[model samples]
Target chain A: MHVLILGAAGMVGQKLTTALIADGGLGDQALTRLSLVDVVEPPAPAAFSGAVDRVAADLSLPGTAEQVVASRPDVIFHLAAIVSGEAEADFDKGYRINLDGTRFLFDAIRLVGDGYRPRIVFTSSIAVFGAPFPDLIPDEYFTTPLTSYGTQKAIGELLLSDYTRRGFFDGVAIRLPTICVRPGKPNKAASGFFSNIIREPLSGHEAVLPVAEDVRHWFASPRAAVSFLKHAATLDSDRIGPRRAISLPGLSCTVSDEIASLRRIGGEAVVARIRREPDPTIGRIVAGWPTNFNARRAAELGFVAETRFEEIIEAHIEDELGGRFVS
Target chain B: MHVLILGAAGMVGQKLTTALIADGGLGDQALTRLSLVDVVEPPAPAAFSGAVDRVAADLSLPGTAEQVVASRPDVIFHLAAIVSGEAEADFDKGYRINLDGTRFLFDAIRLVGDGYRPRIVFTSSIAVFGAPFPDLIPDEYFTTPLTSYGTQKAIGELLLSDYTRRGFFDGVAIRLPTICVRPGKPNKAASGFFSNIIREPLSGHEAVLPVAEDVRHWFASPRAAVSFLKHAATLDSDRIGPRRAISLPGLSCTVSDEIASLRRIGGEAVVARIRREPDPTIGRIVAGWPTNFNARRAAELGFVAETRFEEIIEAHIEDELGGRFVS
Candidate 1:
């Protein structure tokens, strides 16, 4: 089946594309054609047998969504968004890219009016939840996002639910946890430390821990993220029921637990590589995030997340470090 | 103190302005300057001694908010919007007027950040809640809006809360129940029948009941609506707490209750004027609406609603019928 991946140039997008290319399929359906789109043209498909088309365009631009949607892909993966830090800093840019972009794409699919409903897999985030949350946030908690990025994602979830209810498209919004041990160089996302402290330290590089050691967070691996995308693409829509959005399952642990996991896996030397230097900005932002979530709906839907941080670290090492540790 | 009404030409806006004029004051603050704005020029203020400036302008137009905010009124009552039925029918119009217009006004206020924080009373609606609600929806129920109108209102509530939390403005969003016995010629609102069946029959005219007699709904009189706005405006910001939005108290009753109250007030003859004609479209919409809501927050904040449908009808007669119903 033909697949369209929006924001195909980004980190998660690149990983998801690589996974699809490596597998050559999602479930029983083979990848006959892959359409990749981003603000910058995506890298040429690496050794793909399937027909690959790359388009560079901004979804927030008025007509860009229509142009991309005209090709009628069977499955559409909407992964485009400005990161949390940047979105929170720039108000107009945040709403334009995160909110307007998602809406424009949904509206384009709606206006097609040909009764060709595609499966729309939307990438939401844990940012949709805010402070004063229950210890274990249930799937039914109210969305009161603290930042503009969270607000935009929450709005997108609402729009997706409504549009799907209207039969414009079959939509599913997966609220991804902070993907731990994120490969490659760190960026400006507030949650970057969740990955940085683990990935950098394991690679024999010193990594700064900006928050208190006791600070807790939810985590999933990059492998789990790809699994979610693939599962979301093929899962029976009826199983999702009426609520199109769900918080995905993940391992919940404190910062100390992460350090302990590192010690257990790579000894005390690896744990010693994490330097404690608190940044108040990051600390304040992290304070509002939910620490743990009970994703009953996602669990029931057969979605899986790494139960252990060691395995998460191992996955990152195997994928990014060629299964070798620094000498 | 200067007061600005954004939709002064609309039904509720005109009535609210009239009430403010008749009261001769808002809380203890005497009305010094009144600015009335609408797409059509609002009626001249007849009772207030203050200079009344009536301007015809569309809030959706660019730079209109800048002009309005430049006046730097002490209080802004934002009552502007395309109605629910119209908003649901036209998506572009809905987003333009409801979502973008609200944002523009907010941004304009934020830009005027010279320690000038005005009290902004935004009119939200009961549409923020949708189906599968508890028998009596509590303060913290999830906002799963079933219509475009509800979705937009829900988003507005989120923005109002966030902006207020950020100290951009002293804002409060009051989600008013559907006004019972709206005193005018019936229009296109699907909920119009709720008012029409009561008002038209009381006025010695036949009215059609579109849904079943068992369908229930929440309501408040136009007087209550004005009271809500006034209370929202004057409320101490501290009492509003972190979440600046509130669901105003509304009387919840069934159609039979309304008919029973109508029969008691105007006798059996008025009840006889009602004709049953079930329209599935309206039934579907009404079914998704919450019939009973426990507005604990609003009550705690000192806003009240009429308890009995008879009181609601009596309110209509006293206000619209000039203290006498048609014989």
Candidate 2:
């Protein structure tokens, strides 16, 4: 079946693309064609065998969505977004890119009017939930987002559900965890420490831990995230039913556990690579984040993630470091 | 305080305007400028000592929102929307006017670049919540709206709450119940039957009751709705805290209770004026509506609605009928 990947230039997008290329097949069927689109030109795949097409364009533009959908992709993965910090700092830009961009893409699918029902997997975030969270966030939690990024994603999920219910497309919005050990250089994300604490340490560089050792967060390795996306792409419509969004499974643990896992996998020398310098801004932001989630529905749906932080570290080592742990 | 009323040409706008004019004051504050705007020209007020500025323009148009915000009124009542049925029928128009228009206006206020905060009392609806309700919806109920109208309104509420929390504006989103005995000719609203059975019977016209008598709905009178708005305008922001949106207080009654109240108020003759005609479309839509609400937040905020259906009918008679059962 033909598949299209939007936002193929980002970290998750790149990993997802690599996974798709490596698998080379879904279920029993082999991939026939693959299309990738993003604002910036995505790197060419070295291992993809089937027909591959890449386009660079802004999804927010009037006809960009239409152009992408013209290929009649049986499955479409929409993993595009402006990050949390930028979205909060620039209100207009956030709404324009995150909210308006998403709506335009959905509308384009609806406007096709040919009764074409494509499996659309959208990437939502845990940011959709706010503070004073229950000890364990249930699937039925209300979305009262505290940031523009969260609000935009929440709104996107709502629209996706409605549009899917209207039979325009088969949509699934997966609220991904704060992907820990994100196999790249730390960016401007406020939650960057979730990745930096592990990524930098493994690479023999000390990473700043802005929050307390007790500060907890929900996490999934990059490998687990890709698997969730692929599984979401193939899930039966009958099984998913009307509630199209699900919080993907993840291991919930405190910063101390992360450090312990680092020591377990890479020894105490690696653990020493984490520098504790409490930045109040980062601490306050992390404090509002949910530390635990039930994610029962997602588990029931056959989506899985690393239950142990060591497994997460191992997965990162295998996927990002070519199956070798850096000394 | 200067009052700016968006959608000033609509029914609720006219009523609010009439009430303000008749009172000659807003919560003991002396009369001031009244800024009225809509796609069509708003009707000329009967007479008022305060200066009135009427702007005829489409709020959805580019740059129009900035123009409106330029006035920087102290109290802005946003009473604009495409009704449920129309919004559901035309997706593009609904998003353009309802969602984008609201966003533009909100962003306009933010982009003002000065410390110009206004009391923005937005009129939301119970439509924001959908089916499979908990009999009596509580303050924390999740908004899983079944229609485009509800989705748009819910998104607006989220934005309002976030923006208010960020200190961009002092905003309050009051989710009004279906206004009972809406004083006007019967429109095509799916919820129109809620008003029709009461209104048409009193006007000596035959009205259709589309659903089963057991079907319950939340309601508030036009006077009560205005009271909610006025109260929202004057509420201390500190009390509202982080969550700016609220489920306003409303009377909950079944269809049977409504007919019984109508019979008591206007006699069996008025009751006989109602016809039982089952409409599946109306039934399906109404079935998803919230029947009862706790509205604890609104109650705590001192915004009250009539408790009995009879009091609602009496309100219509007192406010619209010159204290006469039949005009």
CA lDDT of B182 in candidate 1? 93
Q: Tell me, by DockQ, which candidate is best.
A: 2
| Candidate 2 per-residue lDDT over residues B8-29, each given as its tens digit | 9887888888888887767877
Q: In lDDT terms, how accurate is model 2?
A: 0.87
Residue B315, model 2, lDDT:
84
Q: Residue A171's C-alpha lDDT in candidate 2? A: 97
* Candidate 1 lDDT by residue in tens digits, A1-327: 899999999888898999898889888989989999999999887788999999999999999999999999999999999999988788788989999999999999999988989999999999988887888998777787888888889889888988888789999999999988888899879999989888887789999999998999999998899999999999998888767888999999999988888888888787788899999999998998999998998999999999988888889889888987653
lDDT, candidate 1, residue B320? 93
The CAPRI class of candidate 2 is medium
**Per model, how many backbone clashes are there?**
0, 0
Instruction: Give the poorly placed runs of model 1, Cα more than 4 Å off.
Output: none
Off by over 4 Å in 2: none
RMSD of 1: 2.0
How would you class the docking of model 1? medium
